[model samples]
Target: MSVFTLTKEHLDVLEEKKLKSNLKLIEKIIRNDDFYSMDQKDMQYFLRVADVLYRYGKAIISDKEYDDKEIWYKENHPESHLYDVVQSDLRESGKTVKLPKKMLSTDKAYSKKEIEKWLDRILNTALNLNIDRDEIIIRVTPKLDGYAAYDDGSTLYTRGDGVNGQDITRAFKRGLKVTKSGKRGLGAGEIVINKKYFDKNLSEYFENSRNIQAAIIAEKNVDDKVKKAINDGACVFYPFSLIDNWTGHYKELLNDFDNIIEKIWNAVDYDVDGVILEAVDSQIKDNLGSTRKFHRWQIAFKRNDEAAEVEVVSVTPQTSRTGRVTPVAELVPTRISGATISRATVHHYKMVKSTGVGPGALLQVVRSGLVIPKIEKVIKPVEPQIPEYCPSCQSHLIWESDHLVCPNKSDCPAQTENTLVHFFKTLGNNDGFGPKNIEKLANLGVKHIHQVYDLKSHQFAMYGFGEKTSKNLYDQLQASQNIEIEDWRFLSAFGVSRLGGGNCEKLLQHYSLDNLFGASVEDIEKLDGFAKVSAEAIVEGLANIREEFFKVYNLGFNLSITPKLSEQQDSSSPIAGAIIVFTGTMLQGKRGDMEKHAKSLGAKVAKSVTGKTTYLVAGTKVGENKINGAKENGVKVLSEQEYLDLIAQ
Candidate 1:
């Protein structure tokens, strides 16, 4: 009945700490679940206790509860010392050593408004540096919920207090492999166990993956099951560089924020609390440095999960490119989490029929992940409004599992128009093919993507576009072909099932774009990460789009090839397998161009100077402090000309 019963283990872990004096107050606050009434000292102590328990993996409260209290504390006491320094989670007795590189936490934004403000700051900084707004790139990756560690090849260190950490290299000694068999020296990453593996093999014995993670690094004999998990590669060290990522222009990121966040959030098998967004431009990152806790160039978007109750006005059916008729509930406009919500989606027609989601229905709506509005619960039952025909085409809809799907995929205007729009949007380099324009083209008999590309300026005018509009459309089409994009992206634009950008890149890493058409289902299934069902689906989808794919592929569109991984490993380039950091302004050419050139030579380019870096290439206006820091880290400092000469040799 007491809250302390649940947190007794955490207290045992913290027996030697000074927080025990406040145990009665902690218990009282935990029971009441109140943060506003607490004095500043009690509030700060409670936060510290929560944080320490969380770091030790015996968390006394859920992350959301902890965050709510932390936010309250910050609002009431803006100048608290808790914001001044990074906290250490490592409690082992080993002496701490300087980290090979700093491992800062990410600043968090709970809503779109906060994210937009961060974007504005990035824009202003880019403008001051004379960088084009379109040129500013953003990189997003899953924020893994696991033990944070840094691998400098020779030793692995915990992220203790940011600057110094205890050596936890014994984890590797216990046969913990890197994720995807990646080579060592990838710098910062986390030690995580695969979710599926834990559920299947260790769930009955371990309370959670964190318990197994703690056992892996404990200064004692490893548990047999934990050792087995490590040997099986189910538990591994995942470097940030090797993790799945989404990179694009900031415009594309904002335009497709929800989809991007969701995709990246589910990209990995490990548990993730949120998605991390960072400016990818080295100059931007250098300009926006770090605070004591987190970097200014990066932020984590966490879910606020605020909920509201509202009455549904009506249910609307919309058709997607996949021919699924989705049920959308329109509600009386209500605000939650600082944003107005007018509509939310029901899972399917099955949910509508089962839950009676119709006009006058009272329902609970929540901002799922503080991003998408979703119908959480049906509060009052009413006769459900179910559509018998597709909303776009008047074709009969049939139940397929839980979904009501439109069978007339070929003639459905919504499907065709959405497919066309998806192609251009996935291409990410063009702006002329929006929904309205695509619908106009579809009305004029533009069904396939190749047909749209085939439209001449005169043809656009024939299609009833204005003279200037026609000219611009044709120019955009030409521009799409002239502008170079990645081959994986080009393949993904076809919109084949199971052939997303990530899958395409993985496939391309092994097979050439031309060779993919010849690949069989068995061949694809044999590759890592592809199952037989997915391989079959991909083969069937490719067959359905084969003719159209060739037509589009042969359009003379410029595409940069993804280098084969095997060839990259065998590369004889002068700087192959070296981690190099470029600093200061370059006179030979643009810094971005130089970094790209280095990557092409099979070298890893890092944004900051670190101990694992093989070379720090200094250019004009180089800072003495930076060069000296590199030297202290034992990195070889090379002048721009000398580096060029060495690579030339």
Candidate 2:
């Protein structure tokens, strides 16, 4: 039987002019429950049908299933137009009016590291303006998962494509009140139904809150029950300005981020999908302006709880380039989040032994963000399956800390293949050297990155590649050389221990890439953020890769050199050594040029405010909140003209 039934009327209403799918085929696909095996065209069709139906309150699948399918489609078809435009439920037949302001989607971050990187941008901006970083105040609010709209007192509009919206003013006319008795003209907010009211009065009738939300705004006559609910104030327009929030210094917010998020996540009665964080300083907001899709100043942190328990079919070991052996648990295919998960990593052999992650073991898996579903825990433990020998070389494995390691780093076919794959993946400027091609080439005696570069089109054809593919591969190799890539990225592609892109960039800022190999452990350790142990490892890794690196380096790839930190420190300009922040719209010059000018003057330009900032350079249209925030943190505010005058002095 079909999981859920959708009437012909429901399909007709949502179809409008969009592509229509055969209902029987859709039902068959659903009943088969083998979405992973389905063709890409069928998946796309199914997703479109599901999305339209869900939006129109006639869902054939659960929200989780819809989300999973959508995620799958996105991963497979990133360039599809489905991602560029907003997913609106509104039909094309409305009086389209320009909104009071653009309501762009909020940028998202899943981990604390991502948030920290965001904070670093704010700090950098503050440095540029000479604003004290500590003066930066951040505000956090619950991100409502409801129909987004704008309130302009006289008109309430739907958030269609952000800039233009349909006049849904009839929503207010139908007795939908503002939350907390809020006054009109609050600009942006969401129309949300109270969760308690939905559970008590509307749960049986509607599939989900989204269904009721769509019904409340439907052009067709509203149901009497929904009208009554709106009249009772169970459904209301909750403005972002009036939403419950937590405001504090950025550091304090970071220190108690989890606690604060939890406190505010449950502060509202409406459905919330995540927490929104933005700089309270208006200057910071203006300085870090909106991208085409979202504001750089604001971000939403979403948590996914799609998890499943599945039995492990077997545990297999794979060798990585670093000689570390990773344990992969092959499982009975189980759906988690929005994808069918057939395998998950066990972290290491230690986990396999300690958690008894073996055949017949029941494991709980949770998918978060875009990461592969992870084994949360072993639910029903069985005998641990630990490999005594490396899967690739059959070399005896040795224990290193909690990991199983293979000492055969040079000869192992798996390590060699993975290293080649890593190099092509990290170069990121070329394609056609994926795992399958790299593995085939490795089997044919092509083991090194430089060796791959030496191949001719005819040679590739000799390796069993087609003439077309061989020519394409040769062209891609040449393209990789011609494409300008950061010197740090080139170094990182070597996959040295403790020297990823970020660390490489940091090290290159102090010394040139050529000088990096000769640097000592103490030289690296003296830099900020690098510990002694990491310095030691990096020094050793660089030594190990030095010979191969020079061979690749001499092959003539375009590389951009990182500027030395000492060069900036030696400048004798008036603002020399001062940390400055620039905010708002600069009237005198382009912001990029201004930043370059600041750097030339020996001033450390920052993106956000911090305690060490010397001045907050305010430009035209700077917000009062930003000025006040800087003042509160003891940063002297300066107008653009005043900054120019001060530099002259």
Candidate 3:
């Protein structure tokens, strides 16, 4: 019934190997979110279309997205990848040039559980091969979200479907630089551009960096801007070995994931979607081997983020509390995962212009975790669309660089409406006052969290909600007040910039919610994790929210006091202060979580349970010879619960 379906017509097109049209229709479906919403047949349609498109240059989504969707479909249907790589499509990829050394796709893991599974495989490997787990090293690198390519001294080739590619040596002649002194060739790498630089200089001219990359490889002439960027060295061919990384044994990696990822994500100025984790063991590599698609020993740990590509059917302006006019993109209805998506937002008008996001433009919507995915890339360009006035408040909108703000913040209905909604969403204690309910409340002159909380039974019907819904909303307000909540969670509910769940927890760990109002920028920044800029904004933001914060804090709802730094220091014990490393596979407990728990007690826990390791906690799969070696070196070997009991003491 929709514009595209996976009918015999689509299959015939697929069978015929019609790439351009296949991509066009697939893009249309993905852009509309229709591909994900279809029946089994239609799901097959868009997925196949996406697969074919990825093999070509014009990907409907990303390689990460394609692989993820393929895996997802395979999990549900199990018959998916069967239709996966048709032999005919393989030939289109070109003759199988045995990769300089077969470059296999990284095995993927969606969660920590899957990571444990990987570790389990490694343990099995050590047991079978008579290897020492302590000697095994694990390495993690940021997976560059860019075009995959391989260079062999003379030729720069696309990682064409993972093996065999057309020689794109001209990309180098076009002046593409090697990232961080990456020389002519050391094997496989990626082509990427600095995100911040692209945002500033080239976005106005190019829709997305992918386009520029495509141009660099196209048989046609290059864009002057692309040439300039290459000349300026903003874009480059980055070898994986040249990039920044985090390396340690498996136990240490599991113990310090958040810290490690934060470091790796900021390691490069380019776009990075996930971290690539691989074992640095030749024996493990040979023993574990690989499949037709991926290597069993190496895995890419990617977050399951939601993303969509939608049309800017229209840009409707709405005023914010700060009088900022945020542009809302009303997309043509589509579905992602299982949800029908029709609306999304842009950061500001400045983002609108520099990013080339306008009416009829195709934009990539990658949701930030569970939150909405902002426009990360503008795929197709159209004439720029500028809103003359705020759609809701009917006030003239003026620009502040990338953002258009309304001067009517004092009385804009949209601002007042969204503000009210933010308060309820932030509290997260009671749920009845969601968007629909709060919108009703705002229309009836209920503007603030306090006002909504103070509502009477009759106030619900006054706002036009049904009697039942009204009473429930009122009860929800009371229930929110009654629920025990944290000081930081309560603070984050207000959605102050730079102050979310993590920062809120960090701030509360240092200062009480009561004292935060008076905390200076210097005072806030003194705490760990609070950078100078965020501290300044948070201090200023807290001052602005003081009246409301006090109003709610005075409500006397149950609140959990975050343990202060002083208290944590006092509770820290010296016995808990040893840096521990786990060696050999533990038969009794999980190596990953055990290290984390050890670190919690002020002990610096480690991977590769070693000679210097304070405690070599042995488990079932641990080798006796390895444990004896550790013991001979004076490392204490604690049994599973014995280590637990030690920590308990």
Candidate 4:
């Protein structure tokens, strides 16, 4: 079996790479015992995959693995693109808009010596600006590990490719409040999940908080749990300006660096990967300037990964919701980095076979702060005991690529129970249908998701549930229906392959819930992100779930319909989808600012007017010939006030 399972979201990102090699080849490269001897092209492909996965929180190789490859690549090929530029986040395809301000990455420092050098640069810059070193203020704040975006009060934009980003204003519309009770338009910030809330409610369903963060900004319907978290103020847009910080002079910062870093790291409940130190003096920052990737005056301090060697007791196979069996190693209790470690995952059965990760095998494990500890290497080999049948159904297993699969998807008790559990869990408005409860019901002959929905209070009582528990379960079912949910989330709960929340929302944008089942593969492929293979899988999966989906969907739940792209394109706003050109600076804002605002409001902003121009907004210094030429082309000429008035309508 494959070591790591890639979601549709991951695949979508991979498809964009257009790599010459397939995923099978990439996995083989990752599993190779000797990375040093791999082909250069293969190594490059592996590096790209590792980079993307690391950013998405589905990192397959550890930091050391990535670093070793990177170091080797740099020494061998100094002119490679990887070394020349900063790798930006893999962005989703959408309307690209400019950020209000450039959000540059902070220069990172790993050691105290490096930090001291950075301080010298700051001091030099301070001298250049003719400011006393003692008067210079350095501010330290927790560097949040979350999705980065810019909030301009009315719109939220992803930090796409640094300068341009996709409009994610829907996050605010979904009731995501600002952290620290801060107001909007606080420039740059992160959309983060509360660590406490994630551990308690979402850890099991999602692999990491990064997954939850991505779901929040996804165009698809947000998960019910995430939606509730946003509403409860557990998830918020934490503007960097409002972050809890320690402000002190340069001397005070250097004197108590360790204590200050520790204090700021623990200051918030959000996931903080590091601490950021920046000069508060704007003049010093301007004098210091920036590189292509990072600002000169700001630096982030990151802790190193901690590793420990542990003996494996045995490897246990657990079947997941998708029928891929994961081999989890049971290790001798060993403490690593303050947390007691007893288990670590062996990526796939392929790894178990190749690496001999059997009973009594010794393994190297590393944990980076609160991140899940990963098995880095098998120190000692042992005969691997592979599973011959599905653990839950005793069905004969088969190999699908590197992963051992239980083909009994329909009848496997584990799959059915897990699917049922996922439905209610994703439907986050419900309660009492956890694993234990669902397992009990599954054992009592509840096979289908709608069957659980069909149960009454007395029926649950018949299955040996307590009277009070049965009533609560029934009430929760009612609440799941009565509480409003988005149609995209409703579709995703069906557990269809290639149709996660993101893909579901993408499809629903083009087709409504009622018409989605009937959408052909060709119809689906027409959407922006859907590739042919994914489209085929989605079409077939939808067909398989059509009956059951309609059964559950027709139960009269409160579902908000996803807005169609066509409907959005046909907006009633006067300037909606209109091509407009803004010339000369005026009183409202910068010309560039006006153009960005127009794009956010659904108007197409162009640099110059042509025959296709719908309106030409004239500012203070427009020449008479320019206005007359625009009028001659049948484009309406409007004063700045007239254009603003039209948009306000």
Best candidate (score: lDDT): 1
lDDT of 4 at 302: 78
RMSD of each: 22.8, 10.4, 18.8, 20.8
lDDT (0 to 1) per candidate: 0.79, 0.77, 0.67, 0.77
Per-residue alpha-carbon lDDT of candidate 2 for residues 1-649, written as tens digits (9 for 90 to 100) = 1133446756685468464546666765554443433444466667766656655656565544455556545654443545333254334466788787878878777678779999899889888878898799989999998989999989998887666789888898898889999898998999999999999999998867887788788899999889989989999999999999999999998899889989999999899988998888888877777654578889887665767888999988877555678787888987654556677666678889998999999998875422345676789999998899888889777665577766543346656666677688888887799878987999899988889999999999999999999999999999999987878889988876567777887899888878889999899999998988778767866776687788899999999776677665465677898899999999989775676678667787776765578989999898775687577556889999999998887
Tens-place lDDT digits, model 1, residues 485-505: 888889887766667776897
Off by over 4 Å in 2: 1-145, 157-170, 173-175, 179-183, 186-189, 194-205, 218-234, 239-447, 459-489, 505-523, 526-528, 543-547, 556-569, 573-649
lDDT of 4 by residue, 305-325 (tens): 788989988888777656667
TM-score of 3: 0.44
Model 4 vs. true fold: TM: 0.47
How many clashing pairs in candidate 3?
15
lDDT of 3 by residue, 237-262 (tens): 99988878888988898888778877
lDDT of predicted model 2: 0.77
Cα displacement (Å) at residue 329, model 1: 28
Question: Comparing candidate 1 with candidate 4, which one achieves the higher TM-score?
Answer: 1
lDDT of 1: 0.79
Error of 3 at 528 (Å): 59
Give candidate 1's error at residue 217 in angstroms.
1.1
